[model samples]
Target: MITILNSDKNEVQKLGDLKPGDRAEIIGFEKAPVDFENFLHRLYEVGFLQGSILEVLQEAPYSRDPISIRIKEATYALRRAEANLIQVKLCE
Candidate 1:
């Protein structure tokens, strides 16, 4: 059984630091805007849904704003606004 762990505020880290090809399971969101529902729906459309597996591809220099990620065998570039809302646990 998969145990769902809540993301602790102290555990927050930059998504860019994740190694390429490493997989993680999304758990919760942080730094969400006031229009959280809309923002979350958009993320879901781009494959950032809860329980989805994500693979970090690359991070741009000087900014983690645009992060390249692979989900469900498809890749996408997400802005910081959306990336910040995604919380994940490193897969072993």
Candidate 2:
């Protein structure tokens, strides 16, 4: 996976890199997956839009395959693979 450096010098981190209680702003997606278009559509439809605020609420106890996150007032679980595709600018 590719890590991005923000123009303002703030660290850009992958959504999967965040731990519980971490908050960030969605920036963009990284290397496109096979169904990139659909992925983007689904993410946007579910409120994973750019500039949206995201908070990591929990992670699976064992494999951590699915991570629970909050966006606005809604919560959703995303697989590590899908999370990695999302790039975010960490909130201080």
Instruction: Please give each candidate's TM-score.
Output: 0.64, 0.82
lDDT score of residue 16 within candidate 2 = 92
Model 1, position 32: C-alpha lDDT score: 62
- The sequence of per-residue lDDT tens digits that candidate 2 reaches over residues 33-83 is 677778767878989989999999999999876899999799999987789
- Evaluate candidate 1 by giving its C-alpha RMSD to the native, one decimal: 6.1
Error of 2 at 79 (Å): 0.8
Per-residue alpha-carbon lDDT of candidate 1 for residues 11-33, written as tens digits (9 for 90 to 100): 64545446566677887767666
RMSD of each: 6.1, 6.6
Best-fitting candidate, scored by lDDT:
2
- The models' CA-based lDDT, in order, is 0.71, 0.86
**Model 2 spans with C-alpha error above 4 angstroms:** 1-9
RMSD of 2: 6.6
lDDT of 2: 0.86
Residue 60 Cα positional deviation in candidate 2, in Å, after optimal superposition: 0.8
